[model samples]
Target: MLAFERLGIRFGGNQAVQDVTGSLTPGKITAIIGPNGAGKTTFFNMLSGFYKPTSGVITLSGQPISGRPTHEVVARGVARTFQTTTLYKNLSALENAVLGHRVRTKAGLLDALLRSGRERHDESESLKAAHHALERVGLERKAHVTASLLSQEEQKRVSIASALATQPSILLLDEPAGGLNPEETARLMDLIRQLVGAGLTVALIEHKMNLVMGLADQVMVLHHGQLIAQGPPAEVSRNPAVITAYLGSHGGGGQHGQSAPAGGASV
Candidate 1:
Protein backbone atom coordinates (compact mmCIF):
# COMPACT_ATOMS: atom_id res chain seq x y z
CA MET A 1 0.00 0.00 0.00
CA LEU A 2 0.99 3.64 -0.54
CA ALA A 3 0.59 6.48 1.99
CA PHE A 4 1.41 10.17 2.08
CA GLU A 5 1.07 12.99 4.60
CA ARG A 6 0.77 16.76 4.24
CA LEU A 7 1.76 16.47 0.57
CA GLY A 8 2.09 19.64 -1.48
CA ILE A 9 3.76 21.25 -4.49
CA ARG A 10 4.12 24.75 -5.95
CA PHE A 11 4.64 26.46 -9.28
CA GLY A 12 5.92 30.02 -8.75
CA GLY A 13 3.18 31.56 -6.52
CA ASN A 14 0.59 28.93 -7.42
CA GLN A 15 0.07 26.17 -4.91
CA ALA A 16 -1.06 23.51 -7.35
CA VAL A 17 -1.47 21.03 -4.50
CA GLN A 18 -1.46 21.74 -0.78
CA ASP A 19 -1.62 19.71 2.39
CA VAL A 20 -3.26 16.79 0.62
CA THR A 21 -3.01 13.52 2.50
CA GLY A 22 -4.39 10.07 1.73
CA SER A 23 -3.58 6.42 1.08
CA LEU A 24 -4.50 3.86 -1.55
CA THR A 25 -5.90 0.87 0.32
CA PRO A 26 -4.77 -2.50 -0.99
CA GLY A 27 -7.21 -4.17 -3.41
CA LYS A 28 -9.70 -1.31 -3.51
CA ILE A 29 -10.60 1.47 -5.91
CA THR A 30 -10.10 5.03 -4.67
CA ALA A 31 -11.86 7.61 -6.82
CA ILE A 32 -10.73 11.25 -6.81
CA ILE A 33 -13.31 13.80 -7.95
CA GLY A 34 -13.57 17.58 -7.94
CA PRO A 35 -14.16 20.68 -10.05
CA ASN A 36 -11.54 21.82 -12.56
CA GLY A 37 -8.14 22.85 -11.10
CA ALA A 38 -8.78 20.84 -7.93
CA GLY A 39 -5.27 19.37 -8.32
CA LYS A 40 -6.42 15.80 -8.79
CA THR A 41 -3.91 15.03 -11.54
CA THR A 42 -1.30 17.14 -9.77
CA PHE A 43 -1.69 14.84 -6.80
CA PHE A 44 -1.17 11.88 -9.09
CA ASN A 45 1.87 13.45 -10.73
CA MET A 46 3.48 13.86 -7.33
CA LEU A 47 2.72 10.32 -6.24
CA SER A 48 3.93 8.76 -9.46
CA GLY A 49 7.12 10.85 -9.56
CA PHE A 50 6.13 12.87 -12.62
CA TYR A 51 6.36 15.76 -10.18
CA LYS A 52 8.16 15.89 -6.86
CA PRO A 53 6.42 17.27 -3.80
CA THR A 54 7.78 20.45 -2.25
CA SER A 55 6.87 18.98 1.13
CA GLY A 56 5.69 15.78 2.84
CA VAL A 57 6.57 12.11 2.96
CA ILE A 58 5.55 9.33 0.57
CA THR A 59 6.15 5.70 1.43
CA LEU A 60 5.36 2.51 -0.39
CA SER A 61 4.76 -0.03 2.35
CA GLY A 62 7.39 1.50 4.69
CA GLN A 63 10.10 3.07 2.52
CA PRO A 64 10.42 6.56 1.12
CA ILE A 65 9.75 6.95 -2.63
CA SER A 66 8.88 10.63 -2.94
CA GLY A 67 10.82 12.51 -5.60
CA ARG A 68 12.41 9.34 -6.90
CA PRO A 69 13.02 9.26 -10.65
CA THR A 70 10.04 7.90 -12.60
CA HIS A 71 11.85 4.77 -13.70
CA GLU A 72 12.92 4.22 -10.12
CA VAL A 73 9.38 4.82 -8.92
CA VAL A 74 8.11 2.38 -11.52
CA ALA A 75 10.75 -0.14 -10.51
CA ARG A 76 9.34 0.21 -7.02
CA GLY A 77 6.01 -1.21 -8.29
CA VAL A 78 4.03 1.85 -9.34
CA ALA A 79 3.01 2.56 -12.94
CA ARG A 80 0.45 4.87 -14.55
CA THR A 81 -1.51 5.55 -17.72
CA PHE A 82 -2.18 9.06 -18.97
CA GLN A 83 -5.62 10.68 -19.33
CA THR A 84 -5.10 10.41 -23.06
CA THR A 85 -4.17 7.09 -24.60
CA THR A 86 -0.39 7.13 -25.15
CA LEU A 87 0.33 4.22 -27.41
CA TYR A 88 2.73 4.23 -30.35
CA LYS A 89 0.30 5.07 -33.13
CA ASN A 90 2.42 3.52 -35.87
CA LEU A 91 3.21 0.33 -33.97
CA SER A 92 1.23 -2.83 -33.54
CA ALA A 93 -0.60 -3.20 -30.25
CA LEU A 94 1.83 -5.89 -29.14
CA GLU A 95 4.82 -3.72 -30.01
CA ASN A 96 3.30 -0.81 -28.14
CA ALA A 97 2.81 -2.97 -25.08
CA VAL A 98 6.38 -4.17 -25.38
CA LEU A 99 7.64 -0.64 -24.93
CA GLY A 100 6.65 -0.82 -21.29
CA HIS A 101 9.51 -3.22 -20.76
CA ARG A 102 12.06 -0.59 -21.72
CA VAL A 103 12.03 0.93 -18.25
CA ARG A 104 12.72 -2.45 -16.70
CA THR A 105 15.28 -3.73 -19.17
CA LYS A 106 18.86 -3.99 -17.97
CA ALA A 107 20.44 -4.32 -21.39
CA GLY A 108 21.61 -0.96 -22.65
CA LEU A 109 21.94 0.54 -26.14
CA LEU A 110 25.46 -0.83 -26.46
CA ASP A 111 24.27 -4.31 -25.67
CA ALA A 112 21.52 -3.98 -28.26
CA LEU A 113 23.98 -2.67 -30.84
CA LEU A 114 26.39 -5.53 -30.17
CA ARG A 115 23.56 -8.07 -30.27
CA SER A 116 24.49 -9.32 -26.83
CA GLY A 117 22.78 -12.29 -25.32
CA ARG A 118 21.35 -10.09 -22.58
CA GLU A 119 19.60 -7.98 -25.18
CA ARG A 120 18.05 -11.00 -26.81
CA HIS A 121 16.98 -12.41 -23.45
CA ASP A 122 15.42 -9.15 -22.32
CA GLU A 123 13.66 -8.83 -25.67
CA SER A 124 12.25 -12.32 -25.36
CA GLU A 125 11.01 -11.50 -21.89
CA SER A 126 9.44 -8.28 -23.10
CA LEU A 127 7.65 -10.06 -25.90
CA LYS A 128 6.26 -12.66 -23.50
CA ALA A 129 5.14 -9.97 -21.06
CA ALA A 130 3.56 -7.93 -23.83
CA HIS A 131 1.58 -10.92 -25.01
CA HIS A 132 0.39 -11.57 -21.51
CA ALA A 133 -0.54 -7.91 -21.06
CA LEU A 134 -2.59 -7.85 -24.26
CA GLU A 135 -4.30 -11.00 -23.05
CA ARG A 136 -5.13 -9.38 -19.74
CA VAL A 137 -6.95 -6.56 -21.54
CA GLY A 138 -8.63 -9.06 -23.88
CA LEU A 139 -6.77 -7.72 -26.88
CA GLU A 140 -4.87 -10.89 -27.68
CA ARG A 141 -6.83 -11.29 -30.88
CA LYS A 142 -5.89 -7.80 -32.02
CA ALA A 143 -2.32 -7.79 -30.80
CA HIS A 144 -0.94 -7.28 -34.28
CA VAL A 145 -3.33 -4.50 -35.29
CA THR A 146 -1.86 -1.04 -35.73
CA ALA A 147 -2.66 1.23 -32.78
CA SER A 148 -4.13 3.95 -35.03
CA LEU A 149 -6.45 1.43 -36.61
CA LEU A 150 -7.92 0.24 -33.31
CA SER A 151 -11.14 1.72 -31.94
CA GLN A 152 -10.94 4.34 -29.21
CA GLU A 153 -12.06 1.89 -26.55
CA GLU A 154 -9.50 -0.66 -27.71
CA GLN A 155 -6.83 2.01 -27.63
CA LYS A 156 -7.77 2.70 -24.03
CA ARG A 157 -7.42 -0.95 -23.17
CA VAL A 158 -4.08 -1.06 -24.98
CA SER A 159 -2.90 1.85 -22.88
CA ILE A 160 -3.92 -0.05 -19.79
CA ALA A 161 -2.27 -3.19 -21.10
CA SER A 162 0.98 -1.33 -21.64
CA ALA A 163 0.90 -0.32 -17.99
CA LEU A 164 0.18 -3.88 -16.97
CA ALA A 165 3.15 -5.05 -19.02
CA THR A 166 5.20 -3.00 -16.61
CA GLN A 167 3.75 -5.25 -13.90
CA PRO A 168 2.71 -2.61 -11.44
CA SER A 169 0.85 -3.31 -8.22
CA ILE A 170 -0.53 0.22 -7.92
CA LEU A 171 -2.34 1.58 -10.99
CA LEU A 172 -3.15 5.28 -11.30
CA LEU A 173 -5.67 6.04 -14.01
CA ASP A 174 -6.55 9.58 -15.13
CA GLU A 175 -10.02 9.53 -16.67
CA PRO A 176 -10.10 6.02 -18.11
CA ALA A 177 -13.66 6.54 -19.28
CA GLY A 178 -13.45 10.11 -20.50
CA GLY A 179 -15.03 9.70 -23.94
CA LEU A 180 -16.87 6.39 -23.85
CA ASN A 181 -20.65 6.08 -24.15
CA PRO A 182 -22.76 4.44 -21.46
CA GLU A 183 -22.33 0.88 -22.66
CA GLU A 184 -18.62 1.35 -23.25
CA THR A 185 -18.35 3.00 -19.87
CA ALA A 186 -20.13 0.06 -18.31
CA ARG A 187 -17.70 -2.36 -19.92
CA LEU A 188 -14.76 -0.24 -18.79
CA MET A 189 -16.23 -0.42 -15.30
CA ASP A 190 -16.29 -4.19 -15.50
CA LEU A 191 -12.65 -4.25 -16.59
CA ILE A 192 -11.71 -2.01 -13.65
CA ARG A 193 -13.59 -4.27 -11.27
CA GLN A 194 -11.85 -7.26 -12.75
CA LEU A 195 -8.45 -5.70 -12.18
CA VAL A 196 -9.33 -5.01 -8.53
CA GLY A 197 -10.83 -8.46 -8.17
CA ALA A 198 -7.52 -9.88 -9.30
CA GLY A 199 -5.65 -7.86 -6.63
CA LEU A 200 -4.51 -4.60 -8.22
CA THR A 201 -4.93 -1.44 -6.17
CA VAL A 202 -6.49 1.38 -8.20
CA ALA A 203 -6.63 5.16 -7.79
CA LEU A 204 -8.14 7.42 -10.39
CA ILE A 205 -9.14 11.00 -11.21
CA GLU A 206 -12.35 11.11 -13.20
CA HIS A 207 -15.13 13.61 -13.96
CA LYS A 208 -17.84 11.05 -14.60
CA MET A 209 -19.84 11.16 -11.37
CA ASN A 210 -21.68 7.92 -12.01
CA LEU A 211 -18.43 6.00 -12.55
CA VAL A 212 -16.92 7.44 -9.38
CA MET A 213 -20.05 7.02 -7.26
CA GLY A 214 -20.93 3.53 -8.39
CA LEU A 215 -17.40 2.10 -8.68
CA ALA A 216 -15.25 3.76 -6.06
CA ASP A 217 -14.85 2.00 -2.74
CA GLN A 218 -13.96 5.40 -1.31
CA VAL A 219 -14.37 8.84 -2.82
CA MET A 220 -12.17 11.85 -2.09
CA VAL A 221 -13.14 15.39 -3.04
CA LEU A 222 -10.80 18.25 -3.74
CA HIS A 223 -11.37 21.93 -4.40
CA HIS A 224 -8.79 24.61 -5.13
CA GLY A 225 -5.84 22.25 -4.47
CA GLN A 226 -7.01 21.03 -1.06
CA LEU A 227 -8.94 18.00 0.08
CA ILE A 228 -12.38 18.95 1.38
CA ALA A 229 -14.05 15.57 1.83
CA GLN A 230 -13.28 11.85 1.60
CA GLY A 231 -15.28 8.74 2.45
CA PRO A 232 -17.65 6.14 1.08
CA PRO A 233 -19.82 7.30 -1.83
CA ALA A 234 -22.91 8.03 0.24
CA GLU A 235 -21.01 9.80 3.00
CA VAL A 236 -19.01 11.98 0.61
CA SER A 237 -22.11 12.71 -1.45
CA ARG A 238 -23.86 14.04 1.66
CA ASN A 239 -21.08 16.35 2.82
CA PRO A 240 -22.25 19.95 2.66
CA ALA A 241 -18.92 21.26 1.43
CA VAL A 242 -18.87 18.67 -1.34
CA ILE A 243 -22.41 19.57 -2.36
CA THR A 244 -21.68 23.28 -2.35
CA ALA A 245 -18.36 23.03 -4.15
CA TYR A 246 -18.78 20.30 -6.72
CA LEU A 247 -21.76 18.02 -6.15
CA GLY A 248 -24.46 20.61 -6.69
CA SER A 249 -27.90 20.51 -4.93
CA HIS A 250 -29.11 16.97 -5.53
CA GLY A 251 -25.91 14.97 -5.14
CA GLY A 252 -27.09 11.92 -3.23
CA GLY A 253 -29.90 14.07 -1.77
CA GLY A 254 -32.71 11.52 -2.24
CA GLN A 255 -33.55 8.06 -3.47
CA HIS A 256 -35.01 9.22 -6.79
CA GLY A 257 -32.61 12.07 -7.60
CA GLN A 258 -29.36 11.71 -9.50
CA SER A 259 -26.22 12.39 -7.46
CA ALA A 260 -24.45 14.08 -10.38
CA PRO A 261 -23.89 17.75 -10.91
CA ALA A 262 -24.99 19.64 -14.04
CA GLY A 263 -23.22 18.40 -17.22
CA GLY A 264 -22.18 14.91 -16.14
CA ALA A 265 -18.46 15.48 -16.63
CA SER A 266 -18.08 19.26 -16.50
CA VAL A 267 -17.60 19.08 -12.76
Candidate 2:
Protein backbone atom coordinates (compact mmCIF):
# COMPACT_ATOMS: atom_id res chain seq x y z
CA MET A 1 0.00 0.00 0.00
CA LEU A 2 0.98 3.63 -0.52
CA ALA A 3 0.06 6.47 1.86
CA PHE A 4 0.73 10.18 1.98
CA GLU A 5 0.33 12.64 4.84
CA ARG A 6 0.08 16.37 4.28
CA LEU A 7 1.96 16.04 1.00
CA GLY A 8 2.77 19.20 -0.89
CA ILE A 9 5.28 20.85 -3.22
CA ARG A 10 6.32 24.40 -4.14
CA PHE A 11 8.10 25.92 -7.08
CA GLY A 12 9.73 29.11 -5.83
CA GLY A 13 6.65 30.90 -4.41
CA ASN A 14 4.07 28.80 -6.22
CA GLN A 15 2.36 26.19 -4.10
CA ALA A 16 1.50 23.63 -6.73
CA VAL A 17 0.29 21.04 -4.23
CA GLN A 18 -0.80 21.63 -0.68
CA ASP A 19 -1.45 19.33 2.25
CA VAL A 20 -3.17 16.53 0.26
CA THR A 21 -3.57 13.25 2.02
CA GLY A 22 -4.61 9.84 0.67
CA SER A 23 -3.74 6.19 0.23
CA LEU A 24 -3.82 3.43 -2.45
CA THR A 25 -4.30 -0.11 -1.28
CA PRO A 26 -3.70 -3.49 -2.88
CA GLY A 27 -5.91 -4.64 -5.76
CA LYS A 28 -7.76 -1.34 -5.96
CA ILE A 29 -7.92 1.56 -8.41
CA THR A 30 -7.63 5.15 -7.18
CA ALA A 31 -8.61 7.83 -9.66
CA ILE A 32 -7.52 11.44 -9.23
CA ILE A 33 -9.67 13.82 -11.29
CA GLY A 34 -9.49 17.56 -11.57
CA PRO A 35 -9.54 20.50 -13.90
CA ASN A 36 -6.37 21.64 -15.61
CA GLY A 37 -3.60 22.62 -13.16
CA ALA A 38 -4.97 20.76 -10.17
CA GLY A 39 -1.51 19.45 -9.23
CA LYS A 40 -2.49 15.85 -9.91
CA THR A 41 0.72 15.25 -11.80
CA THR A 42 2.64 17.15 -9.15
CA PHE A 43 1.37 14.76 -6.51
CA PHE A 44 2.35 11.84 -8.73
CA ASN A 45 5.82 13.30 -9.36
CA MET A 46 6.41 13.59 -5.64
CA LEU A 47 5.09 10.11 -4.98
CA SER A 48 7.21 8.62 -7.78
CA GLY A 49 10.23 10.68 -6.65
CA PHE A 50 10.62 12.89 -9.72
CA TYR A 51 10.22 15.93 -7.47
CA LYS A 52 11.08 16.26 -3.81
CA PRO A 53 8.19 17.44 -1.71
CA THR A 54 8.35 20.80 0.00
CA SER A 55 6.29 19.37 2.87
CA GLY A 56 4.91 16.15 4.30
CA VAL A 57 5.86 12.57 3.62
CA ILE A 58 5.02 9.61 1.36
CA THR A 59 5.30 6.06 2.51
CA LEU A 60 4.93 2.61 0.95
CA SER A 61 3.76 0.07 3.43
CA GLY A 62 5.37 1.55 6.58
CA GLN A 63 8.59 3.14 5.29
CA PRO A 64 9.23 6.64 4.01
CA ILE A 65 9.78 6.95 0.22
CA SER A 66 9.39 10.66 -0.34
CA GLY A 67 12.28 12.64 -1.87
CA ARG A 68 14.07 9.57 -3.12
CA PRO A 69 15.38 9.71 -6.69
CA THR A 70 13.13 8.37 -9.45
CA HIS A 71 15.20 5.27 -10.03
CA GLU A 72 15.31 4.54 -6.36
CA VAL A 73 11.56 4.73 -6.18
CA VAL A 74 11.21 2.36 -9.13
CA ALA A 75 13.66 0.02 -7.48
CA ARG A 76 11.51 0.08 -4.39
CA GLY A 77 8.49 -1.39 -6.23
CA VAL A 78 6.98 1.81 -7.62
CA ALA A 79 6.76 2.49 -11.34
CA ARG A 80 4.85 5.00 -13.44
CA THR A 81 3.88 6.01 -16.97
CA PHE A 82 4.06 9.61 -18.13
CA GLN A 83 1.19 11.65 -19.54
CA THR A 84 3.10 11.55 -22.79
CA THR A 85 3.66 8.07 -24.07
CA THR A 86 7.42 7.64 -23.85
CA LEU A 87 8.98 5.00 -26.00
CA TYR A 88 12.01 4.43 -28.18
CA LYS A 89 10.46 5.18 -31.55
CA ASN A 90 12.84 2.96 -33.45
CA LEU A 91 12.90 0.09 -31.01
CA SER A 92 10.75 -2.99 -31.30
CA ALA A 93 7.89 -3.15 -28.79
CA LEU A 94 9.58 -6.01 -27.03
CA GLU A 95 12.82 -4.10 -26.78
CA ASN A 96 11.13 -1.06 -25.26
CA ALA A 97 9.39 -3.23 -22.72
CA VAL A 98 12.62 -5.00 -21.84
CA LEU A 99 13.96 -1.66 -20.62
CA GLY A 100 11.50 -1.79 -17.75
CA HIS A 101 13.29 -4.79 -16.37
CA ARG A 102 16.46 -2.78 -15.88
CA VAL A 103 15.48 -2.08 -12.30
CA ARG A 104 15.53 -5.82 -11.69
CA THR A 105 18.63 -6.66 -13.67
CA LYS A 106 21.75 -7.91 -11.97
CA ALA A 107 24.08 -8.23 -14.94
CA GLY A 108 26.72 -5.52 -15.25
CA LEU A 109 27.87 -3.63 -18.32
CA LEU A 110 31.02 -5.71 -18.35
CA ASP A 111 29.00 -8.88 -18.35
CA ALA A 112 27.02 -7.64 -21.35
CA LEU A 113 30.22 -6.68 -23.19
CA LEU A 114 31.74 -10.05 -22.55
CA ARG A 115 28.50 -11.93 -23.29
CA SER A 116 28.84 -13.75 -20.00
CA GLY A 117 26.42 -16.41 -18.87
CA ARG A 118 24.90 -14.03 -16.37
CA GLU A 119 24.20 -11.39 -19.04
CA ARG A 120 22.64 -13.94 -21.35
CA HIS A 121 20.51 -15.37 -18.58
CA ASP A 122 19.39 -11.95 -17.40
CA GLU A 123 18.49 -10.98 -20.93
CA SER A 124 16.48 -14.15 -21.40
CA GLU A 125 14.47 -13.46 -18.29
CA SER A 126 13.99 -9.83 -19.19
CA LEU A 127 12.71 -10.71 -22.62
CA LYS A 128 10.35 -13.26 -21.13
CA ALA A 129 8.99 -10.70 -18.73
CA ALA A 130 8.68 -8.20 -21.53
CA HIS A 131 6.64 -10.68 -23.53
CA HIS A 132 4.43 -11.31 -20.56
CA ALA A 133 3.91 -7.58 -20.12
CA LEU A 134 3.04 -7.20 -23.78
CA GLU A 135 0.48 -9.97 -23.47
CA ARG A 136 -1.10 -8.26 -20.49
CA VAL A 137 -1.70 -5.16 -22.61
CA GLY A 138 -2.87 -7.30 -25.55
CA LEU A 139 0.18 -6.41 -27.60
CA GLU A 140 1.99 -9.72 -27.66
CA ARG A 141 1.15 -10.25 -31.33
CA LYS A 142 2.77 -6.92 -32.08
CA ALA A 143 5.88 -7.39 -30.02
CA HIS A 144 8.15 -6.99 -32.99
CA VAL A 145 6.43 -3.88 -34.32
CA THR A 146 8.28 -0.58 -34.24
CA ALA A 147 6.97 1.82 -31.65
CA SER A 148 6.47 4.62 -34.20
CA LEU A 149 4.28 2.46 -36.37
CA LEU A 150 1.73 1.72 -33.66
CA SER A 151 -1.57 3.58 -33.42
CA GLN A 152 -2.16 6.18 -30.71
CA GLU A 153 -4.02 3.79 -28.42
CA GLU A 154 -1.53 1.03 -29.01
CA GLN A 155 1.30 3.39 -28.11
CA LYS A 156 -0.35 4.27 -24.83
CA ARG A 157 -0.90 0.63 -23.97
CA VAL A 158 2.72 -0.10 -24.87
CA SER A 159 3.79 2.65 -22.52
CA ILE A 160 1.76 0.94 -19.82
CA ALA A 161 3.13 -2.45 -20.76
CA SER A 162 6.67 -1.17 -20.35
CA ALA A 163 5.85 0.09 -16.87
CA LEU A 164 4.10 -3.15 -15.96
CA ALA A 165 7.20 -5.05 -16.99
CA THR A 166 8.93 -3.44 -14.03
CA GLN A 167 7.07 -5.78 -11.69
CA PRO A 168 5.94 -2.90 -9.54
CA SER A 169 3.79 -3.11 -6.44
CA ILE A 170 2.24 0.29 -7.16
CA LEU A 171 1.75 1.82 -10.62
CA LEU A 172 1.13 5.52 -11.12
CA LEU A 173 -0.46 6.38 -14.45
CA ASP A 174 -0.71 10.02 -15.51
CA GLU A 175 -3.71 10.57 -17.77
CA PRO A 176 -3.98 7.10 -19.17
CA ALA A 177 -7.03 8.04 -21.23
CA GLY A 178 -6.01 11.51 -22.26
CA GLY A 179 -6.48 11.26 -26.04
CA LEU A 180 -8.22 7.98 -26.69
CA ASN A 181 -11.55 7.70 -28.46
CA PRO A 182 -14.58 6.10 -26.79
CA GLU A 183 -13.84 2.58 -28.01
CA GLU A 184 -10.15 2.88 -27.25
CA THR A 185 -10.87 4.28 -23.82
CA ALA A 186 -13.22 1.39 -23.15
CA ARG A 187 -10.51 -1.09 -24.01
CA LEU A 188 -8.06 0.78 -21.83
CA MET A 189 -10.53 0.71 -18.96
CA ASP A 190 -10.94 -3.02 -19.29
CA LEU A 191 -7.16 -3.41 -19.30
CA ILE A 192 -6.91 -1.38 -16.11
CA ARG A 193 -9.63 -3.45 -14.48
CA GLN A 194 -7.75 -6.59 -15.41
CA LEU A 195 -4.67 -5.22 -13.72
CA VAL A 196 -6.56 -4.67 -10.48
CA GLY A 197 -8.07 -8.12 -10.78
CA ALA A 198 -4.54 -9.43 -11.04
CA GLY A 199 -3.76 -7.78 -7.67
CA LEU A 200 -1.78 -4.70 -8.70
CA THR A 201 -2.45 -1.33 -7.09
CA VAL A 202 -3.11 1.47 -9.57
CA ALA A 203 -3.38 5.24 -9.14
CA LEU A 204 -4.22 7.28 -12.17
CA ILE A 205 -4.63 11.00 -12.90
CA GLU A 206 -7.39 11.35 -15.44
CA HIS A 207 -9.65 14.10 -16.73
CA LYS A 208 -12.15 11.57 -18.10
CA MET A 209 -14.91 11.70 -15.50
CA ASN A 210 -16.65 8.58 -16.73
CA LEU A 211 -13.57 6.43 -16.23
CA VAL A 212 -13.03 7.84 -12.78
CA MET A 213 -16.59 7.25 -11.66
CA GLY A 214 -16.95 3.82 -13.19
CA LEU A 215 -13.52 2.25 -12.73
CA ALA A 216 -12.09 3.73 -9.58
CA ASP A 217 -12.66 2.06 -6.26
CA GLN A 218 -11.87 5.42 -4.66
CA VAL A 219 -12.03 8.90 -6.13
CA MET A 220 -10.23 12.11 -5.25
CA VAL A 221 -11.09 15.50 -6.66
CA LEU A 222 -8.52 18.24 -6.73
CA HIS A 223 -8.94 21.94 -7.28
CA HIS A 224 -6.45 24.81 -7.05
CA GLY A 225 -3.87 22.24 -6.05
CA GLN A 226 -5.70 20.73 -3.10
CA LEU A 227 -8.24 18.01 -2.40
CA ILE A 228 -11.85 19.25 -2.21
CA ALA A 229 -13.49 15.84 -2.03
CA GLN A 230 -12.51 12.16 -1.94
CA GLY A 231 -14.41 8.94 -1.33
CA PRO A 232 -16.34 6.34 -3.28
CA PRO A 233 -17.41 7.43 -6.77
CA ALA A 234 -21.10 7.98 -6.00
CA GLU A 235 -20.38 10.04 -2.89
CA VAL A 236 -17.76 12.11 -4.67
CA SER A 237 -20.06 12.73 -7.63
CA ARG A 238 -22.69 14.21 -5.29
CA ASN A 239 -20.41 16.41 -3.19
CA PRO A 240 -21.56 20.00 -3.57
CA ALA A 241 -18.02 21.31 -3.56
CA VAL A 242 -16.97 18.78 -6.16
CA ILE A 243 -19.83 19.83 -8.42
CA THR A 244 -19.03 23.52 -8.00
CA ALA A 245 -15.36 22.93 -8.69
CA TYR A 246 -15.46 20.37 -11.50
CA LEU A 247 -18.29 17.87 -12.00
CA GLY A 248 -21.04 20.49 -12.30
CA SER A 249 -19.54 21.49 -15.62
CA HIS A 250 -20.52 18.04 -16.93
CA GLY A 251 -23.76 17.39 -15.05
CA GLY A 252 -24.73 17.43 -11.40
CA GLY A 253 -24.22 13.77 -10.50
CA GLY A 254 -26.74 11.51 -12.33
CA GLN A 255 -24.76 10.40 -15.38
CA HIS A 256 -21.48 10.81 -13.55
CA GLY A 257 -22.61 8.59 -10.71
CA GLN A 258 -20.98 5.19 -10.14
CA SER A 259 -23.92 3.41 -11.70
CA ALA A 260 -23.47 5.22 -14.99
CA PRO A 261 -22.26 3.13 -17.88
CA ALA A 262 -18.53 3.42 -18.47
CA GLY A 263 -19.03 3.86 -22.20
CA GLY A 264 -21.40 6.80 -21.79
CA ALA A 265 -20.80 10.37 -20.55
CA SER A 266 -18.09 12.59 -21.90
CA VAL A 267 -17.35 14.70 -18.82
Top-lDDT structure, candidate number: 1
Per-residue lDDT for 250 in model 2? 57
Tens-place lDDT per residue, model 1, 176-252, is 99889889998999999999999999999988877887799998888889999988877887778877775445544
User: Which candidate gets the maximum TM-score versus the true structure?
Assistant: 1
What is the TM-score (0 to 1) of candidate 2?
Answer: 0.92
Model 2 poorest 10 in a row by lDDT: 255-264
Off by over 4 Å in 1: 247-266
Candidate 2 residue lDDT tens string, 83-174:
99999999989999999987788999899999999999999999999999999999999999999999999999899989998899889999
Model 1 alpha-carbon miss at residue 258, Å: 14
Q: Which lDDT value does model 2 have at 234?
A: 85
Candidate 2 lDDT (Cα, 0 to 1): 0.87
The TM-score, computed over Cα atoms with residue i paired to residue i, of candidate 1 is: 0.93
Clashes of 1: 0
Q: What is the lDDT of residue 175 in candidate 2?
A: 91
